[model samples]
Target: MRSVNNHCDLYDFSIWGNEDVSSGKGAKDENFPVGSLLISRKLRPHVQAYYNFARVIDDIADSEMLSSEEKVKRLNGMQAVLCDDVPAPDRADVQAARYLRNSLLETGVSFDTATDLLIAFRQDAVKNRYETFAELLEYCRYSANPVGHYLLDLHKENADIRPAADALCTSLQILNHLQDCRADLIRLDRCYIPLDMLRAENVDVQAVKDEGTISGLRNVFDYILDYIDDLNREAEQLIRLTSNRRLRMESSVILTLACSLTEHLRKEDPLATRVKLNYKDAIKAVLYACPHILR
Candidate 1:
């Protein structure tokens, strides 16, 4: 019942510090690879650090136990720690910010790439419904695009490649939204699907709670998938624009996975069951990455 407008003490990290609220999910728990073998071993630590930081903030936003006000307060505390405005508490989540702060200092990557994610997490703490696809993309710009920016900076890849990187990251974000649409709606009462599209198709937001996909909902899914197709097409340039061989291979593999997942979403009903990449998809991603190995 806490009000977000109230002047909550940002330093009161102790309220939720009694217990960890992290989903306990890690890089491997993600749908895509993270700091995998394709990345240079020397830089892997930085990638892991960034991932840990992102994971912590994302968990704060998604926690059901914390009120929206508490979530925002904790997130602000973490951001303050990341920017060196305050000392990190003993809490694991707050400590994650300190770890990434050190990593950024070591690597010389801009802190903006990391701070931008907080913008999306803050939005997640309060905002649930996306009114349009453009709005969702704006969310992804902060939530997903910063991930690409971090990797590109980490690898010293050209800034020009960001367009393609953004395409891939945004595609992946939408894919996840599609895959988790039902769970997101049922558990959090959040819907990432564009409300306008749902209305255009005559589908209500609650339709996601059904055991199976309705015809109207299916139309909405296809509408989103078709946009993902365009994104994948643009994302193909990522593999080509990347100068580092390992990064190119990694981009190729992820691009393949994104396309494969898009196909899965297109053919499968996410509401009926989980639609995700399988072992066959993994094999395909590796095979696709092979050609880029010697590049």
Candidate 2:
């Protein structure tokens, strides 16, 4: 609730704040996989701070070493920090919270977007599998939609863009879930693929662990691809609606990659192998997307 700029310093902290991520992975560079050059340099860090907040909380929620009770306590501590309800445990949490306070005072980033993300993270602490596709999507509204809303707020775009942006963000989340389905289950006991869909295809969770394949789940891959296509198509409206040239191009690049990956998923079994977009395709996506993006 309280603004952090004058009271707290963001520069003095990193996301880890002396705690090891063990993976040695640093903060989530909101600009990295996407590229800093695509957007203004000045704006990158401000938004990346939000990403750092997400990464830190995600670590707390996703860390395999911690007991569920510990993760929940740490996560609730974050909510308290955000609410100015309690003192931050580290300089990074304080700094990240400060950045959000400033964003609300300056660029119109919503408190709900910042806070609701925790709800999803908390859900991760307990919930394992989604019973239906619609259920998974409802989760995406909490987990993914906040991100799109925040981005729009950052760029000062029209509020109407939120729906389309939500679609784009949700598509990315679902795609990543499919790509990492094997790791998620084996590592965290979490499964993002809806159970009903898998059942309809005649597959079960054990089939996933025994082998990467969808455990005799016929049409599973196609079903996922079809959903990806639908979500991507719906998100195209957002790409076209984006007002800023840089943001528009950036969204286009993402959409291009999303489509290409969907095509690849169609050809390969996601349950069996992790599909990566090669460097060539990555560069091509930028080039192809740049045309309309620059317009």
Candidate 3:
């Protein structure tokens, strides 16, 4: 939330404050973070501050060494810091903690929303399987939707926007999970796709884990992609409801990218190959998405 004029500073704070996200390792998507930082600057300072805090705590939960219990402790400590019960902890995430305490002092966020995010990240620490799409949506209800709720609250948007924002956020989260399925399986030992869907498609998890190349993979991928397609269409309606042009543009572009990834994956089996957009392509994506981005 601090004025991070330098790209180096933004990247440093993002990485240092969020050492838990290994997904940044493969091919860095600087544009997304750059856009986020720019949007943070354009919006309220507390918006960016809270997001940074959320990201850092998420990273802590995702850390390989930290047990779920330890992650919960860190989150509880963060709550203590948030409530001003104690001095900030000594760690990379502490700057975020201190910033959050200050932000809370300035503009308060509901305790329920705050706790939901921590609980969601904690869910990531242990929960590895989703039994149904409904269950996965419940996960996003905590992990992704609260962000939109916070942002919407910042803008003083009415209850009408919550439904739209919630739908968009959950759609984006589901698309992200589908796109990262293979990597998530390898890295986190987690699968976001519901077990019910897998069973419906007659897919076997053990074979996919072992061979990583089975007909069942293709069928399951098809099923997942179809489900993502429906969410994407639903999210489009929400983009129109957002009053802020930049936020609309940001959300739209990201959703477009998700849709693009799904199309690409549908064209080629991800198990055989992973799809990545080069910098030039990503730049083009941002460019194409610019005109529609409301302010």
Candidate 4:
């Protein structure tokens, strides 16, 4: 499990070579929308390569073993290598830089978005708590929005859908933060729950970390769950924004999963519960996501 402090990036590439559940070749992004995969098969490798590079920083940001100074030093070196400002320091950064550079050359994925991710990763080295939701959203601009922006470029889609995509991406990022709050606090001594919100509810962050879901904190979790519902609604616009059926259907599936997961969190306390799709709902999510073009 990754720490809460590491929520700065969504690139889930494994530092460990992964097994592709699809072809059994290499690893795949666990959170990647299945519909997107089916529709965007040609784009996956380039996307995965970028993710693999992103994971190199993930390895650094989430390392419990390294001190902040060491982590910052290594991240700076990785950044220098990635930007071609310096030589590759080691194998992982070299591979990441090589793949990411190749991806920039071959695909329309934005280099600026990737650089935004680097800035977010750098923040994780030095910062911990966000004072408010607005602050957190500002952070998400760098950490989460870039993934959506990259995807938009990959699809050759214009900015018409970028707003909805950004909402979906940020919602996913927040969902992850809420889901991992307790564990993150325990393992990383970090809490992503907005301090103001927690104080308003008279819910101390440490109490949730130590005691799981207390009744006092239920309101905060419920509010977040409601926000997720709004995000899901906002994302429904994404499916209708483009005429590309593949992209539309892909958005449908991703939004469906988001709605289902948010509904799951409403019923299950994220502080104490780990919610995943049951078999029936998982199948339904996919089926419901498929449009006539795909069917």
- Model 2: per-residue Cα lDDT over 1-295, one tens digit each: 3222332432333322455333334533222253346767867876777776777778777888776776665666566566563445455544566666565556656777777788888899989899988988988988888988887878889998888888888888887787778888899999988888888877776666644564345376577778889989999997789998888887888888888877776677766678767677678778877678547
Pick by TM-score: 1 or 4, better one: 1
Residue pairs clashing in model 2 are 212-271
Q: Which residues of candidate 2, in runs, are more than 4 Å off?
A: 1-23, 26-35, 91-95
The alpha-carbon deviation from the true structure for residue 49 of candidate 4, after best TM-score superposition, in angstroms, is 0.9
TM-score for each predicted model, relative to the true structure: 0.95, 0.86, 0.78, 0.84
User: Clash number for model 2?
Assistant: 1
Stronger candidate by TM-score (2 vs 3): 2
On a 0 to 100 scale, what is the lDDT of residue 117 in model 1?
Answer: 92
Give the root-mean-square deviation of each candidate in angstroms.
3.4, 4.9, 7.5, 6.9
lDDT of 4 by residue, 1-295 (tens): 0112432221323322232112122233444453246567787777777677667676666667666776665665555545553443335445676677677767756677677777777777677787898888888888888887877787788788888998898888888787778877787776777889889988777876754687768888788778877877888788777566676776677677777777777788776666555656657677986663553
Give the least accurate 10-residue stretch of model 4, judged by summed lDDT: 16-25
lDDT of all the models against the reference? 0.88, 0.72, 0.65, 0.69
Can you give the lDDT of residue 239 in candidate 3?
A: 70
Candidate 1 regions exceeding 4 Å error are 1-8
Better of 2 and 4 by TM-score: 2
Indicate the TM-score of model 4.
Answer: 0.84
TM-score of candidate 1 against the unseen true structure: 0.95
